[model samples]
Target: MILGLSKHPSDESIVEGILAGGRKEHEALVALYKKFHVSLERFIIHRSTGRDYAKQPEDIIWEAIEAFVVNVKKGSFTLKDATLETYLKSICKNLWFRYISQEASREERQNKYMAEWDKLEDDVSDMLIEKENWENYINLVNKLGKNCKQILDMRLIEGLSMQEISQKLIANGTFENDQTVRNAKSKCLKKIMELITSNHQ
Candidate 1:
């Protein structure tokens, strides 16, 4: 109806046209967007309201559309028994869930770090109560060369995995593989820990 097809095309036909990779593909995508975009936006807005960590509804909707298109083209979406809208909505839901999970993890890490900071204060007493030692440790970490600092920051502060860090480093020509990143991380951490322990005594 939307695309002016003589009759309603099957989901398979539409998907095939999209995967065909030409002007037909472009028309298919436009047709899909016109058919679903408003409903998808409304659905996302309804679901994300009042959630502080939720992504902007527009962003979520657009990302969902992009994921859906890419996944469909890549054959990841089979569209076996479900309607296209249903499949798209499921993708949006999964994306929202991922966002929520990451937000929760970030908050949890922050709370844990805060509790550890308090304990460090108690353990060190007034001798280092002003957090001078903590500052010094930060300084030592900063002195550990740029790549080491970047690796540690990405892994610890950003909660990225070793493999992700390795890819980033490799892209920047820092090191070739995850093993190199791991070795560098271990060496940097050991150096910092040794510095702290020796200075504490």
Candidate 2:
């Protein structure tokens, strides 16, 4: 059933297939998956804590390939922006983020999904432990002063651009100017980084 996960093949051929953006493009994408899946899976397996995620690395690879093909088709990206390796790696990273986000969302939506799915308890425990450890660190940050927390929160959590945050804070009268907020932000972040780096659970 699997086709490509065995070799890198010719990069030019793969790139050409991707640039084609049609049925052949899909097939070449599939071929690229078959070529890279095993190696990628092995790479993730070494790092993924023996979870089922390691079992589905190819799915992530395919998602990345599909998204990349769509981007190429839609003119969202050009071949000039990247080589095959850079493009594929960026796709893989984005796919991993999406996969993780979806997985987390699903778990939150169906807390008992695992209980019904027939997985080992120890594996579930491992997931829970990692989740709890991360939450604890977040809780530590929650203990920060409100302004310090808000600065980090806007920039890091809300994913706001620094310029945007500067404008927003000035509008709200949080500081006299944008540079003031930026300076305050740098100090708070450095302090929090030091705190968490030294005291992370």
Candidate 3:
């Protein structure tokens, strides 16, 4: 009936077709879209009624389908107690929630960065009386210890969050946690202030 295939292919057959690849994979994907697209679209629209999604409902459904196909091919999707429909819906929900969380987190970080930058400028301006003194301040920042310099550069120059900096440091076994990065960044700022004050004295 659909794509010259049976009216309803069993879930096992669909999985097999997808794993087999080539024309079978293409047919399987088409069949899946035909079977579940409307229901999934309704579900997504219902769940995301008031939300501001960057992607449209159709786009999300397609993305979910692609993710499902990829997961099946990768052996990540094991239809145990749940049906294929259930699994696909779960993926769609998770993707949407993750997108929302990331957008919220990005906004939060931008706001925090702006506030911190404003305070930093105010503090530095008060300390550095002349243009040359500002140059001295930059030199002082560079003269900080390796960890301090890297953390400041990541935070100030690269605009990375403390959590992001922590992850990078943890990968290389430099620092343990975000709290540690926070402590180090604070110390770096204090050290700069001390150096600036001493220069004036």
Candidate 4:
């Protein structure tokens, strides 16, 4: 039989039951979670910064509770210095840090993939337009000068807005402003077209 509890059990008793494991362990952890879940969820929501992450507040709370139970059973939680709530918060905080780091890395990889895809778009444009003479088209595009290459790569291939490209170029001292970026794009497209026509002939 499980130990008796008139109402709220002491934290120490709950911890001991969990450490003992089996039916009593389940009862103790459930009781602990029921007693503190609302507060823990509130804490997670407050800390999540209005961003939906790998888990919702409730999910994080439950996961943390489960981990706490296991750790208590394994003797990893001494529970001598801090309250149970404090330890639970620590676990939740660690989860948030891990989620944020993973999200950042995922975003970085997506940006890199997008950049590469944009470059490929430029490389394959000619092939898409002139299926029969794709080889000649590719050869002609390869012969474009460095300036044309850069202009098209940024404007067409990279999918950057003209204003964005303009700011970047101006910052790099490549051009004076947005108008220059536009003019350069026009010239580059004209040159590429000329190369394609001449190669066709």
Q: What is the C-alpha lDDT of each candidate?
A: 0.71, 0.64, 0.77, 0.73
Task: Compose the digit string of candidate 4's lDDT tens values, residues 1-201.
Answer: 224775677788789878777888888877788778888888877876796676677777777888887788677887785789899889887876677778889989867855664555454565436556545644665688666677667765577776787788888898887667766766666677666656556
On TM-score, the leading prediction is 4
lDDT of 1 at 78: 76
lDDT for residue 139 in candidate 3, whole number 0-100 = 80
Checking candidate 1 for backbone clashes, the offending pairs are: none
What lDDT score is found at residue 84 in candidate 4?
90
lDDT of 3 by residue, 16-118 (tens): 8889899888888888887888888888888775856677778878889899988888888877847889988888888777776787898899789657755
Q: List the RMSD of every prediction in angstroms.
A: 9.5, 18.1, 9.4, 13.1
lDDT of 3: 0.77
lDDT-best of 1 and 4: 4
How high is each candidate's TM-score?
A: 0.51, 0.41, 0.51, 0.59
Q: After superposition, how far is residue 69 of candidate 3 from its true place, in Å?
A: 1.9
Candidate 2 vs. truth: CA RMSD? 18.1
lDDT of 4 at 127: 46
Point out where model 4 deviates above 4 Å: 1-3, 126-201
Worst 10 residues of 1 by lDDT: 120-129
**Ranked by lDDT, top first:** 3, 4, 1, 2
The number of clashing residue pairs in each candidate reads: 0, 4, 0, 0
lDDT of 2 by residue, 41-145 (tens): 565445454556532776766676778777776878776798655677777766676776787787786656434322332333344355565465466557777
Best by lDDT: 3
Residue 81 error, candidate 4, Å:
2.4
* Better model by lDDT: candidate 1 vs candidate 3: 3
